[model samples]
Target: MSKREMKIKPVIDRTFTDCMEQLQEGYVCAVAATAGCTVEALRRDLFGGDLLITRDGKTAHDQEVSLLLQLKNTTTVRPDPDKETFSYQLKKREYFDRLAAPRKHPKLLLVVMTTSPNQTEWTKGTHDSLEVQYCCYWRSLEGEQAADGVQKPTVRIPTRNVFDAVALTDILDRLDRGEELT
Candidate 1:
């Protein structure tokens, strides 16, 4: 076929938000797998949560600990000069309320911030490795009150709460020990 006639149309168009969400979800899934846990995607986005994590092979009523995660992605989060924390504004009041409320399952807001603004640089792959250019932080809003009449509520996430395999394992261990995740 002639080069001019070989142009192919894009099959599906995904917005930047969609791509970011997918990337963050993939990262969480990988981390959970490595930590010997299982992640379930909530198709309906119930309770403003995107995913649920359950400890593997621990079904005892006392030992069973399931975590609910609300995943968010952005390229705009800039940490404070001290690098102690960063803030993210949640757009939905419902989400804020749900996350802040006490529930049977602990819920956390997991925000994935991209290091670069360029979407093309978000991921890189080679035979030896695959790298995702983003870092995630987790915050628990339980017992916190949302500002009344505010459509969007901003929450601060600690830099120390990096969402990684170690962090996941620690969170699970804490939950299994009947300790609060806060």
Candidate 2:
């Protein structure tokens, strides 16, 4: 048996790890703003992880549904590599496997986000103030399993599977009939 530190050297890269939760929350908020959904950020330790989607404000008066959110962003400080490429180490695959199981009504939805691949910036207001183009993709990991015995798995999220408002709408609609997420 090896010590934890010896087995894994945790690297905290400010470029990516800094304000990470904010990036995910911001993206979800931006998306929900247009889609008429309400998002609630969950506690860090709570398994299944982050964000709960509710019905439109105008529709059910802010009633929540069965949808759990797990966000992954590709926004990093690396200068040359493609911004669309993002790698994440899933610490506890067992927990993920259980969270993504179909037996749960509120399935875990993994959202992968990235800035523009070209690294192009668009004007916000002043010419000096610019922001990178943002995009996101989502997939339901229901019934996904860990490796035969691997504890931590590094997964790569690609750009081609980018999802938009349409996909979000579909997921939200599906949750309407189920139990609300608490």
Winner by TM-score: 1
TM-score of 1: 0.84
Which segments of model 1 are wrong by more than 4 Å? 1-14, 58-63, 80-82, 106-109
Instruction: Tell me the tens digit of each residue's lDDT in model 2 across 29-145.
Output: 766766776777786736666787765444556656546777766543222245664565566676557555675556677776654322223114456743425666665556566
lDDT of model 2, residue 26: 75
Candidate 2 Cα errors over 4 Å, as ranges = 1-16, 56-64, 75-89, 115-132, 154-161, 177-182
RMSD of each: 6.7, 7.6
Per-model TM-score on C-alpha atoms: 0.84, 0.62
Residue 82 of model 2, lDDT score: 54
Q: Residues 1-182, candidate 1, lDDT per residue (tens digit)?
A: 65522332222334655777778889999989999888999999757788989876455445556788988776667565478877889878887888888876554655545444566777799999999867788888888987789989998889888899999999988877768777
